[model samples]
Target: MQPTSELVFAQLKSKNSNTRCFDCDTKESDWCSVSHGIFLCLKCAGKHRGFGVHISFVKSVTMDTWQFKHLQMMKAGGNEELHEFFDFYELGNYAPEDKYRTKAAYYYREMIKTVSEGRVLDREKPSIDEGKIIVEEQKRVMPQKVIEKAAEKDPQNIKALIGDAFEYTKDLGRNIKEKVSDVSIADVENKAKEAFSKIESKVDSWNFKEKFNSVKTKTEGVYNKIAAKAKKAMKKITEEQDFDDSKLVEGEDELMLDPQGKNGKK
Candidate 1:
């Protein structure tokens, strides 16, 4: 059964759509050579048009009108199918120069002949289990462990590890030197000397002798006043001590002195 236009367009715009030009593999292909059922970039499409309509009928995906037959042809055959059919033995290996217009034209001509003969028009599809077996065989041929061991045994890998370690050590040493240089012994000594000089200057500015003399004079004055008071109190106590209770004059009570001699009153 023929596929719908929607299904055909959906396949074309998919992420896994044929993004590379079939002839050169240049990315962002916007054109498709409808007859050959292959995608092509603008540059490659122009070259295909030069080959003439009978050889390569080119159409733009965005601008061209797609008929039901055109869409059916695209659905039936795509870049992968065409490539597999043309390069069945995988012998048509094109070099860089072969990817240009002239060489691509030759392949397109050969493709036309194959299409006319209808060799790849309705080939049988491979079963899912067959595809799985093919994948498993590829894995068996080149195991992941083998590749890993090969990389580990490489001399370049060892040299790279050693180089990285050396760079790390060099960077660490540079950082340590930078930290050490930030603090200098001479700078510390200069700061200490400046602080000591400030303290000595402050001490020199004070009038210590004048202050001491002033304090001593005040202290002597206070001591004299205290001595005078004590002497007066003692004299009164001795004079009173000679008198008995009968010797006390009338209206006079016995004199009493505080033990501290701070106060003397009758």
Candidate 2:
């Protein structure tokens, strides 16, 4: 991670698309999101961090230590590849509620749709304009680091996915049976099987396990800080209650605080 940062910065600089921020195209870009595999300027980087690391993992190209896998993801997609996949009407279409930036929307909805289909990422594809052929130049070669969920080994997660698929299948089977009162049990079973197969396929296809882990860890940290502050507030309230009885109540103060009389014959 230490010396690898230097290598990452050098690789990113080699591309023209990496020259500017992928989000705002701002000059002097220095930050990036490892999750989405896009470079970002300083300000947009803050927004990505705010989105939570699970959705977007922001890191400095020069300041932060780098991992080899992180660099590979960045190469898989930068401004050029993302633009080609998204086909943005506006160059910097970032907003406060950037659905396009969310992990589900980006990794699953749009980009995944393209990948799942027969079509490739369209990186080297040519776009025709006025009958003039134009081919997008390949800036840098990307690694074959596949996108997958890191949670495949967790049995609980696997069970949850299968459970969800079953629930959906049940609903579909019921609907089919209702539409045709004479529909046989075998027909309904077939429908359920198809439904389960499609659902299971989607689950297996979009495995985003480790990316979410990074976000989950940071989210837990934020909650832990809040819990600590809540405990401090409770302690202060307890102290305040003690002060109230000591200063305001005459007979009740000893019973509430010490609960013993020093002058008593014990």
Candidate 3:
């Protein structure tokens, strides 16, 4: 196969309608015809094709050296060898053993590795940082309007939270409904007993009365409607059944004729 630089030169040369690589077509005009075949012009030939490396002894060059300069700055900060390697690249100079090029590639690999690790570590523990951020946010004092404004600015977050809450409640309801539909009356009573025990534990142990009261106050209107329905249901059930243990334990009183009655009257 042709060398990478030769391939690039051929590709660029094919850019011109009037020009074609000895083996292919190109439309670019910056290619020069050498003895054996077409070659890249001085500028294109010296610079790396799409950021690989530079070829020495091409003539005039046009590729920006800013990235190389920035690399130099980084080397100045702490990478001494980086500076030397970059100098080698910038001047189109290479050692006989490819030492400069190898060192530069090594440093580039390390930088790439460092960046990759940073990204992986960042995503792996986002929630830890996020928790700290949320805590700081909670500590910050702002007007209610400001809080609402912030939420409005990030409407996607608000929408996402609302969607999450809706999905959670919907899933919960579906699960409970499915369980209720499949259970016998006895199972319903057992589950209700378990739920009551859990509620009692919460009521007895949880000390957030202020928080509970605030929520209760906000939901008082809905609570009133529910309470009314519950009272009506309780009243209906009580009317159909007697709660007197005496009536059940000692059957209902009966009046009989003198044959069996204590008062011997007809």
Among the numbered candidates, top lDDT falls to 2
Instruction: Arrange candidates by TM-score, descending.
Output: 2, 1, 3
Q: Which stretches in model 3 have alpha-carbon errors above 4 Å?
A: 1-154, 166-220, 238-266
Candidate 2: which stretches are off by over 4 Å?
Answer: 1-3, 88-96, 101-104, 108-266
lDDT of 3 at 65: 21
Winner of 1 and 2 under TM-score:
2
Per-candidate clashes come to 0, 6, 9
Clashes of 1: 0
Candidate with maximal TM-score: 2
Whole-model Cα lDDT per candidate?
0.43, 0.46, 0.29
RMSD of 2: 23.9
Question: What digit string (tens of lDDT, one per residue) describes model 1 on residues 107-144?
Answer: 44444545545555343333323322211111112123
lDDT of 3 by residue, 1-266 (tens): 42344344344334443242222223332332211122343223322121121211111112212233232222222223333434544522443224223434434334433443343222322232232221111221222442354355444343333233233322332232222223333443344334334323343213333322322332232223223333443443333221111111111111111111233221
Preferred candidate (lDDT higher): 2 or 3:
2
For model 1, the stretches where C-alpha displacement exceeds 4 angstroms are: 1-7, 15-17, 89-91, 94-266
For candidate 1, what is the TM-score? 0.34
